[model samples]
Target chain A: MPYIDIQNDLPGIRGLMAFSPHTAEPMGLLANALLHHSDGLLAAERELIAAHVSYLNDCFYCQHSHAEIACYYLDGDRQLVDQVRTGDDQAAISPKLKALLRVAAKVQQGGKAVQPADIELSRKEGATDKEIHDTVLIAAAFCMFNRYVDGLGATTPADLGSYPPRAKQVAENGYGPHIFSTSQPAGPSVKPL
Target chain B: MAHIDLPDLPGIRGLMAFSPETAGPLNELAEILLRDNANSLTRGERELIATYVSALNDCFFCSNVHGAMAGHYLQCDMEGIDRIKGDFASADIPAKLKSLLRIAGSVQKGGKYVTISQITDARTLGATDREIHDTVLIAAAFCMFNRYVDGLGTQAPPDRQYYINRASQRAAEGYLDFELYKYK
Candidate 1:
């Protein structure tokens, strides 16, 4: 049960997004621009980064959902996805991704937690400035997202199996239409400040 | 100097310029979150929420810039904003705002840190579901902004006057028109 009556049966951020279509519209766009689009990083690599951050934050829904998307792009490598999420050094991922994850972890700890050496390491491993920037943003965005979902005590499905289906759709279509343009009216009548 | 080769403009301004693709949607979010008149929150109240979260994150640039925006809309001085940033509970503001600030502070600590009592408290004080909803988003969004600004080793000038002067122009211009609000 969510802290507020969001008036939706959808789990996690979906319910929250449905509750606030206004914020959802841009947030969905941000997700599209950040994770779904082609960039210096592959969509799988980007989803992997997002999943890693979500795992660090302990956001079960976000981690699993994005991890499944990542798995879709990584030749369905669930084991590799798990390795990336756990920060296992022996994971088969490239050195550039490992370096980027280090930076992402630091951003998860705090903004200032990311140091000069972290950036240097990523660049040393062949991470571009754009890749580094997006990694930090993805990590930082997940922190907010984790807090939003948990802060509201948003509903989560009891079974992990429930996520992969939605994950498949998310992987196929990206985030915009999935989250935005809901038929539900936005929640709550606010008092003027 | 930043960790990357960002434009010479300081803080998020330069970072956004570096990636126009992400910048467009981000600025749109900012404009709607802070400046939307339909919100029950005054732009000043919403800015204060941003200031409080940025301050808790110890993000000097975000704290000061949004702090100034809060002051600009609320007609308070920098010191007044400082008091709110320092301890919003003790600041001379409405009971409703105090509760909202408390909620935002919990969000700064972590999402799960926000309690059921906090939600109930805000409700008892007359915050609507939308207000609570936006409050969480504002706090969450600032976490993203704060990290982006500092995660890249962006410069945060210590001079308070620069932010203070910029606040008026920024308040008039809002966040979307990135070209108008510039400082190095």
Candidate 2:
């Protein structure tokens, strides 16, 4: 159960957002910009990085949700998603992506854990400065997201069946206003702060 | 410094050099987080939360800089701030603040590490729900800031006076008006 009264059926951060829509707006905007914006990295690659970080953090909801999105972008390659989650090094992905995943892992451990050589390897593998920066931000942001979901004691539903359909929606629609358009009214009345 | 050919900027400022466009919004978020008075937490308590998380992350610059800021606001000396950072539980502070620190520490480790019992403990100590909410955001934000500084291998000055000087300035002016690029 959530630490506070929240929508019990909604999974992970969705419940928390339902509890506070005011905060949800900015959070969704940031997610859309980071994961779905059509600029630096491909959406699938960004989702892969997010899933990898979620996997490392042991955030079940985030890992499953983003993994489903990754599979969608990867032409329904669920096995490839599983492989990336298990170990990016062994996964049959581009060398640049593997190098980028290494940087993301370092960000997961701690910021200082990322060394100069890691950046060099990524650059050698054709990753740009922007890609590197986005990778770090994505990894760091997920740390906050994962903590928010679990810190509040939000539920991570055991049924994997629910995630794919939602992931398909999120993947197709992007994280916009519709993401928080739920039947449950915003609860607990978050005071403006 | 870590991997990229960044300009010779000092401290965390150097890391921002990699993505100058992000520096503005990132600094804006910091301003809202640390300087804005919309939340229930006092400026001193908020700064302490940032310092505590920075210390936990082992980011030397952030810990020292925010530690100085925390001391300035609390009217405490370095020794007091050091005591709080060393072991907030035993520090000469209120019980409620200590409970919040406990929550911040749990966030530093991982989100799932925080438990319902911890929330209950905080509530028992007279912490309002908004206080708990702000504490979690502060802890989460510091994780990002700490990573941004340390992830790029930005160099932290060794002299404590460097941070003390910057802290005095930041406390007086806040984070908004300050120029981030000139330091390079």
Candidate 3:
């Protein structure tokens, strides 16, 4: 039950579905980047950051899905997941990771919340400038993504395992191969909906 | 410069930091959960979703960092990152992913953005209820994270490698070992 009429007929918040920047093409691109891109942070760590940020925002969808995905990398450690979901950074991870998560948490709360002391501590733990920057970006990005989905009232499946296969495929194929509902191939020339 | 004032450096937004009992604990718990939880979605895919959401929000700081992180799990080309960030539908991703991204997008805007068709479509592509729920949560949470960072005008490091090494370390350590700062 969405509050507004979405041009796309979404399930969550109808208002955002019609107005949010989400579209088949861009969505695919974003997916590819998230799964296929090469960079400093590993996929698992990045997912951890996302889940953490989403939890802070209370974005149910983002937190749940990313958490599921994160499990794939953690050797299916549900206990570890519980620890993260419970806000215990001191569970069983490494000191550097703990430090990084700390900085990430600060970012999720507010950039200004990230203090010089935080940076000094992370650096002491061997966190580099790029790591700090990436963590902040990851936190900031999840915030927007959470708002977009919740705002539009997008439909979500009832089952949780529904995502792994798709995640696996996306992880394997990237974003360029998946298209939805368009009779024509995706391109700039394609008419805007 | 940020539109709001610093939370404590003598400004109106000075009261913005997360309280230990409030968003602080919640966010920390979330980080651990995603890192350790098991269901369906892969850690790489989840990170990718988060990164994409950040990019859509125009949160430059988040987009780059997460982008790099997602890259680490990608056993192949970084081109996937470009494709997803550019256009998901036209990109080379698999069907399940397309649906997941669609769900993630819905969350990014708001939960209401998703539609029955989207869920059905995801299921048709083999997405489960948990997958759908998690995707939505990720999107919703990122919204808060993005706003928190942009709202405060956090500074990002200029070096790319800085993110890489840190990412490598976090990837190996996992979130359970995350530490908290005890300011004196």
Candidate 4:
């Protein structure tokens, strides 16, 4: 149960957002820009970075949900998603992605944990400066998202079946629409200051 | 002198030079988070949250700059601020702020590490839901800010006065006014 009386059924940050729509707006906008935007980095790769960070943080809802999204972008390669989540070094992905994942891992540990050599390695692997920068931001932002979800004691769906459909919806429509959609019954609307 | 050739930049600005696109929104987010009055947390308390997380992350520049801002807002001397950073529990501060700092520490570690008891303790000590919410966001945001500064190996000034001066300017002028580098 959440520390506060949020909707019992709404999973992860969705319930928390419903509880505090004020903060949710900006948070959702940030997510849309970071994960869904058509930037230099592909959406799948960005979702992979998010999933990897959530995996490092052991945020079950984030890791699983983003992995589903990543799989969708990667042609339904859930095995690759699992591999990246567990250990990207052993995962069969491009060296550039592997290097970026390394950078993301360092961000997960702490900012200072990332060293100059790491950036150099990523660059050597054909990672652009933009890709490297986005990787760091995605990793850093997920730290906030992961914490916000778990920190508020938001519910994590026990059923794996629940995530893929939601992931499809998010992949198609982005985060803004679903953030305020009341189709799913939420808890009493409270002001999230 | 950062990993990237950011001429004369120091602290977080140096790292942000690598990607100006993200920096715009991030700076906007900081302005709203630190200076906005939407929440009841005093700017001093919010700065203390940032400083405490920086200290935990061992980011010298963030700790010093934000610590100075925190001291400025709280009317605290350097010694008092240092004491709080070193050990907020025993520091001479209000019980409520101390409890909130404890929660911030947990956030710096990992979100899951924040236990229910801590939340309950903070509530018992009169920290409102907004205060708790803000504390978590501040701690979480600083983790990103600290990483962005140190991840790219930005240089920190050896002279503590650098941060003290910067703090006064930031407190007065605010974060939005900084002319950040555009690397597009």
Candidate 5:
């Protein structure tokens, strides 16, 4: 179904890292900070940004994966995740997050899409400078991530349950341990030029 | 400086879901997914993928914000976020990430830009299906996000501190508690 070959099974980035332990380190570090680090954006909001962006990009893997994690923090409400995916602004989210999502949506369309009023509105909603900045960052980072998966034609799990535990682990442990999965390689790793 | 106008803040979508109390439910759900959802990708790497794509897309807000996030995850020795934005190929990152970045690049160009061999190459460098999947999603999503921001012409704060301080809080409290502004 994908454009390329990917392993049938194996955790998220873990299998890829296993293919090349050395090369996976930096990614692991990035994951460590973005997901687990204390100073970075909250894991839930990060996932929301990821999910929202994935929805916009039509990246199935990201959409499904983050959707499940979102449910976990949403008191196990899957419908809410679905609502966000649909871009239903009236999806019962907070004004702040709604504003942030608007910014994220704008960012997904392109950075230039975000207007000055958006910033003022976010500020009015108590979205601090860092939150606004991170919202944009979250949108931007997910774009690269979306392309990486879709670009390579990597394996995407049919089962939504497959991603949450992994997400939780990455949230807790970081990327170092799973870079080079001890298991056999299941997917291709496209090297960046 | 942006190419587009930021869509109505609290426009149709938010207005439809009016009331901060009512909106709390959605924010709570989003918060869990954004910050709490765990994955194999390290915080820095995920943020790096985000930052790299932002740079590629030329979304200044995302590039700077996520760059700082990636920097937060890195150790004292590495350039971290700078390397990702400056030159992913030579950023002292792992071979797989380099490979992943390639995939990310292709996504930036277009989904069709990614090739089978690229996947193999990334696998050769130790990438998993989930990692690859996440990469694609991140790249693809960022494209939309970049467009959203750029498309709407959202404002970028004048100072880096604005981004840094806010980012730290979002990093700490998640999205639910951070809601500060409200509209009639």
Candidate 6:
């Protein structure tokens, strides 16, 4: 059970967002700006960054759900999801993305943890100035988001399989509507028990 | 010196300038989180939470920036803010804020570090759900911000008054309009 009665059955950050639409609207916009709106980085690459940071933070709901979304963008490449989770640098990704991921990892540890060397590596791999800026911000944002979801003990769907369809919806429509979910799916019509 | 070729603007502002796209919504979020008075927690209290978390992360620019804002809203001087940063537990402030700060402190370490008892204790001390929710979110957001500022190795003005002098202007303007502050 979440520490606060979010008054909904939505899982993870979605539940928390529903509880506070004031924050939700802006937050959803931020997510869209970073992930959906094109600022040079591919949607899949950006989502991969979000998913990988969530994976580092050990937020199951975020990691799998975002991976599912990234998978959608990647034409169902589950292997990238696997490699990103394991922080496998050699995992068949563009060298630029791999370098950015390394920088993201440093941001995940702590802010000061990201050394000049990390930025150097990203630049050497041909990452743009904007990519480096977004990479750090994306990593930082996920750290905030991961804490928001977990600190309140938001619901994590027991069924990990449930994330893909929702990921599809998000990948297609973007994040705003989901955060302000008006249509709560009716409870399980067929009880598992 | 920032690792990236950001303009010489100080702190998070420079980073925001480098990426105006992300900065738009981020500034909106900051306004809602720190300045919106509809929630029970005062702007001062929320700003303090933001400040303390930045201090904990050792991000001098953010700590001082929001610390100045906290002082501006709360009407306490920098010495009081310094005391709160030193150890909020011992600060001369409300028990409710202390409780919330304890929860904020736990969050500064890691999300999992915030125990159930801390939440319950905060609730017991008259913290509404929104307050608890806001506190956690503020802490989380600052972690994001602290990383964004420090991760790029942005420089802070070594003089503390650089922030304090600007607090009045910033607190009046809220978070959305970086243009008004001429931070660009």
Question: Which candidate number maximizes lDDT?
Answer: 6
Instruction: List candidate 2 segments past 4 Å from native.
Output: A6-9, A20-26, A181-193, B182-184
Listed per model in order, the count of residue pairs whose N, CA or C atoms clash below 3 Å is 0, 1, 140, 0, 149, 0
lDDT of 6 by residue, B9-35 (tens): 888888877777778888888999899
Candidate 5 chain A — worst ten consecutive residues by lDDT sum?
A: A184-193
Return the clash pairs for model 6, or none.
none
Give i-RMS (Å) per prediction.
Answer: 0.8, 2.0, 11.6, 1.9, 9.6, 0.8
Candidate numbers sorted by lDDT from highest down: 6, 1, 2, 4, 5, 3
In candidate 1, what are the lDDT values of residues B114-171, reduced to their tens digit?
Answer: 9999999999999998899889889989999999899988987789888998998888
lDDT tens digits, residue span A1-193, model 3: 4323334533222223233323333333443344334465677677777777778767765676567566656766656864775569567876776777777777665555667677678779877655665566567656556665554454554445554544444344444323223121212221211
Residue A108 local lDDT, model 3: 62
The model with the greater lDDT, 3 or 4, is 4
Model 5 agreement with the true structure over A64-136: per-residue lDDT tens digits: 6666566656666667777886678778877887888888887776666677888778778887655665576
Model 1 DockQ vs. reference: 0.82
Off by over 4 Å in 6: A182-193, B178-184
User: iRMSD (Å) of candidate 2?
Assistant: 2.0
* Runs with alpha carbons beyond 4 Å of true place in candidate 5: A1-13, A37-41, A171-176, A179-193, B1-106, B112-184
| TM-score, structure 3 vs. true | 0.46
TM-score: model 2 vs. ground truth = 0.88
True contacts kept of each: 0.84, 0.54, 0.39, 0.48, 0.49, 0.88
Could you tell me which residue pairs clash in candidate 4?
none
Per residue, candidate 4 scores C-alpha lDDT tens digits across A1-193 of 7766654457788877776665666667667878996578889989999999999999989998899888878887888898998765788888898988999999888887888888899999998776787788789888788877777667887666667777777887888637445564323322211
Q: How accurate is candidate 1 locally (lDDT)?
A: 0.86
Model-by-model DockQ, in order: 0.82, 0.57, 0.16, 0.56, 0.21, 0.87
**TM-scores, in order shown?**
0.94, 0.88, 0.46, 0.90, 0.51, 0.95
